[model samples]
Target: MKIVAVFNYLLSFLIAYWNTESVAEDEFIYGQFPSYFRWGIGTSSYQVEGAWNLDGKGENIWDNFTHSTPSPIKDGSTGDFACDSYHKYEEDSKLVKSIGVDFYRFSISWSRILPLGTKEKVNQAGIDYYNNLINSLIHHEITPVISIHHWDLPMPLQNKGGWTNEEMIEHFGDFARILYANFGDRVKQWFTFNEAWVICVMGYGDGIFAPGVKEITETPYTCIHTILKAHAQAYRIYDLEFRDEQQGQVGITIDSGWLEPSDPNKLEDIEASERALQFKFGMFASPIVFGKYPDIVRKSVDERSKQEGRSTSRLPSFDKYWTDYIKGSYDFIGLNHYSSYLVTSASSDPGPGWYGDQNAVTFQDPSWPETGSTWLRPVPWGFRKVLNWIKNTFNNPPLIVTENGYSDLPDVGLNDYGRIEYYKGYINNLLKAVIIDGCNVRGYSAWSLMDNFEWASGYTERFGLHWVNFTDPSRERIPKESVKYLRKVFLSNGFPKPTLPWNSIQLNEQCAAVALDPDTSF
Candidate 1:
């Protein structure tokens, strides 16, 4: 018996060694996310499915927005011919399966589905494109999680006042109903909006992203109101008309980044940071979960509205029925987490007051991770903390981590150990949030399956675990070491056993066996 115990111990040590053996400079994150977690990758229409204005598709807001003024995006770049996944999704899916992922989270371009963004006339060609895409995924045994919209509103809608129009609620619902009728059978999951904060602030208020309009007071606030109403309308439509029949869940994707103070002991800085979060993630989450906007947002904005002599709240209010209608519309919360920052109250300076009249404090973390992008720095602990904050604050809503990844400089090399390290750190923190802190995390999809247009930053930031040769006409795909590494993990059912041939396909069998046995814990 003693010898058997000793033998088991020996195997454990061997497994650990093999897993970490010659691992590059990054991979040492500690903690676990959750057991039975789903793993996959992500991409969006404009960024990847670049069939812009192709195949009888009608022009959406992005097409018009980008074409009219391309300078607002980071590199004056547009998604005219992104990764060309619109034509080459088969090749893209091959890369996904090669990594042995079980799911693929992507968005259906509104313009692609309803060229004019209406239910009155469905675009059969657009519908066929997604039908084939969904069918291809299922053929490869991959689950498809679809986002209904990812910030690319149709140009016609904008001309009609876009989110500024209360009628958008019905318009968006019409769109959702059409999506449900066609794709509901195969695509069981859906996200209504990608990130309201960025869509409102960067896209409209700051004129940074597509549909670039700038620094307009009350416009961003009004957009949020219309957006919330639209989300509620679409969600109610799905629940009342399609959920039971289709057997699917629907939700909205909220962009959340952790806020910290440059000096933890400074009361003003801490207050400002918390307020920053309220403005960003809370503006969305609080409404759905707690049945109202963040108290601070309501209070501050009301005063601002009053000071500006607005007769009502800058934050819109729904009738009690609509409040309830919007409050519990989500089945789960889709989160996009990339990094955290330290925000301090603006000290009487003249920067546009974003999160309440505040000060500038650069985003800092003593030992955060870095991606290829200059604006983003990774903070794994921030992820765990953010999850816990959401879990506790929102009464533990089920969660699907829709997008989390490290964007490094393009051509960082095929063996991007930096990315591998980023995954380890974030995934570990995710597990800690789930197991240790009790956040209800169900799945994780890395930011991208393959790098594409990357929006304003253009094609410069590569977030894919698998690299794409954008310059190559064929747009060849190459698996970075992360593809193999994450495959080892997913195949292991968590972390690969530290044993010989750590990257071996045999580990997948072991993982399948363990997953089936129901006795494994990560």
Candidate 2:
């Protein structure tokens, strides 16, 4: 019943927003996908490059965590040799070009760029590897969308108390500047950090990921402050320093799933859902987009801190410069969305519950389909709802989806029908937003270009449109059935036939043709 209502609400919202005639033509009709539009697929350094301690690369939190604590990962496996894209990137770039994307979005490993987490000494190899990747992408006519940080923090920085320490803001900004000076000319789209919620909350709040620290009340809040501060500082540096020369745009990507209160009319449940909103979405969005923490966040955390007898809200404060620094930081908004959750306030008091989800909120929906990656559930309507929420909340800044894809269990085959289904549904919802809702959403990047490390879940969950053979030294990439379909969507500028059960389209031949000559996607 709850799921039905949420779907009904989303469908009606689409109906109000949609106008099929305007976007009914080919996908390319949107003006070379807007001069700002980017069709990209991404891979993070730690997740794909897999050269933890080689050629002067410094240690990072992931390096230490994966090596120091094995069992914390699902299969007790590390990313020591995952994908090995560092050595075989030429081949990988060839694959990316084959897919006919306009851009390649990959993160620079912080430890690789600044081994000591400082500019005192630059790692030549680290710079060279990325330079090669960037040059290769450009050589093949693919633009580069670079992320300055993506979960991999230099171990030295972590040892110095990481995000908990105030100094991190300036240090991270300096690092961003260095990249700005070096590659900003070629890489027009720069992302300061991937998603802070996963970094601070999941990693700090729950200790499930790297830099693993389980300090919910204190740590997560403090970490949020540092991440935002760092992002703001980075954005300011890039905006001031490189914007004129490189003429690029910068923004931080945030993760937010749609929330449906078990009962929207019920105040407590609604408030609980909103709190979850302020927690999951607001955790990062409030600071970046709104320039301050949400009211619910500050109040709730303040009261909690008072109960704990803390000096003040664990959430840090910035001086006037920072207040100004953090405001208007984004050139555009980058969002990674998947699934939706049903939020019902937990039992009132005096009961045990899920760690992060204590009397907090419960996420369940009988209608949503689960993924091999247990953290995800298929909820297509949620994508449109969340995108709309972002537009309304941020007054509709230009939006781009940095990451979105389905994950499957290891046993899933190369020809994944479920993956195809997931893409069609979410993308159809996305088209609904662009056509009906008139969202300024300009670009989309598949979650991953290749199968790489999946953090704590290890290699158990696969989200790549192209499968990576872990045992193969070459890490051979095989295009999944979904990849072809996605290319067609990209080629079409997301125009769709007015229909339901939209996952039965075919595109294997197109995939083969596109892969044959990646440089000329058209």
Candidate 3:
């Protein structure tokens, strides 16, 4: 018995060594990534799927929000006819194949599948539409990564208070069951929600996004609680009912801008950075992973609620039953990181919003490169910092970078050296996180396959490998110079050794034709 135990221990050590040999030998000095690492791009249904009311499609909150308020969306435009991907998805699939990616991540519109957000009747047309899209992806040898919900709730559900209501738990579960029943055989990776923070805070607290409400304290908490429960329910349903047969993984995508202390030497600044993360990504992530809100978050929110004369904490509390249900609910954690912000302790509260709750002031360094959106500034090193944060906080859960890309200003032609540089910096750091720091990072996906509706910013901010011509009725998709660079990186499975400068690779003729003057900045 003693000799057998020694042999088994030796075998275990050898297996561990062999598993990490690639990382151990390379030391992440070069960007040579694990050959199995994936490179893909994504698009949300509402953002890219036009034909809003076509083919028995029901309305979503975005459809109502945009059409109801004439100027709610930026540029006074709506996603009603945004990219027309509903009709042009074959072209989109061809574009995905052109990029030579392993997978394509996309969301299904809730209303498209269940017009009234219920299982009373499933729309065959909606099922047919997604079947066509999924089939095309499989045919091209591109795996389909599907997000169950990406903030486009059916308008009928919005009428019943949407994510703020507990009924959404079962409603969303039914939606998940339908998806699993239909697509689970081919779809191995399932994301329950794209960014629960954005869905809860932006939609309810700020009133800047869909189903805009602006209730701030109570509504944001309530909405997020509902979303968390819904997510857990869907995960449990999949784990119990479908996971065995489908052999798939289910998780949720949580997004946040990396927060750094403005003055790292000061405890107040450091605490502010921690609080910023707690309020943003940790709000949704903690419940699903750790089974409750962070201790700091619970204490802060309860104290504030008491001071505000509330009978209960403003942040919702999960019962023991729900807590256990949500704990260990995810197979992986999806991170959609874009930029980093310097956070400082706030002297004055901003008032009545998610930012107000954190009591922190955030600003971008002027030295950072600005993108189309004022809020976005590339800080490549922050990628590894945030990844390490997740590693330590979640005890090194498998992570997929579900979204990361640089956005260029509209009308900027395809000489996207800036975006190429952005990708190189972030992806290089991601490789370091995986190889050097030992973060169980599995995959990386660019923000989008092509430019489409960019939420409230509309089409003004372009974050696509392919430049989409929104003005053209046909919505021509043009591959940017960055696409070529990205393809080479995907083919190499990492940054090529002896990295080339952004401008080192000559642009193809199609990209060169649209290049700005030699003196112009990218």
Best by TM-score: 3
lDDT of 3 by residue, 1-522 (tens): 546534543443344334434443222234567877888889999999999999888999999888764677888888998889999889889998988789999999999989999999799999999999999999988999999999999999999999998999999999999999999989999999999888888898888998988788789889989999999999999999998899999999999787888986676776787778878888988888899997667877887878778888888899999999999999999999999999998999666446677889999899998888898898987777788777766678998999998889646788887887788778877887887778898899998898889888887788988888898999988988888777777766874444224454543332332221222222
Per-candidate local distance difference test: 0.75, 0.76, 0.84
Compose the digit string of candidate 1's lDDT tens values, residues 1-522.
Answer: 546534543343343223333332233333334467888888998888777888767777777766763265666667878888989988777777887888998888888777777776677888998998899999888999888888888887888877777888888999888888998999888899999878788877877676777855667887887888888888888889988889999898998877766676665665566567778888888888877888666766777668777798666766898788778878999999988887777766443235443334546665665568877887776676677667655678999999998887555877687777677667766765665556788888888888778776787788887778877877777877777667766765565333336456886666444322323433
Q: What would the per-residue lDDT of candidate 2 be over residues 1-522, giving only the tens digit for each residue?
A: 556544544443344334433443223221123345557788888888887788999999888888874368888878888889889888888888877788888999888889999989898888888889999888888888988889998999999999889799889988999888888778888888888888887787788887889877568777878888889888888777778878888888888888766885665565566667667776677666767777666666666556667777566666787777787788887888877888877675422112233345667676678778766888877787677766765677888899998897557868676877787667767766776666799888888887789999788888898898888787888988777777766665553332333343435344333323223243
Q: How accurate is candidate 3 locally (lDDT)?
A: 0.84
Checking candidate 3 for backbone clashes, the offending pairs are none
lDDT value, candidate 1, whole model: 0.75
Model 2: which residue pairs collide?
Answer: 17-436, 18-436, 27-492, 27-493, 97-518
The TM-scores, one per candidate, come to 0.87, 0.87, 0.90
Each model's backbone clash number? 14, 5, 0
TM-score of 3: 0.90
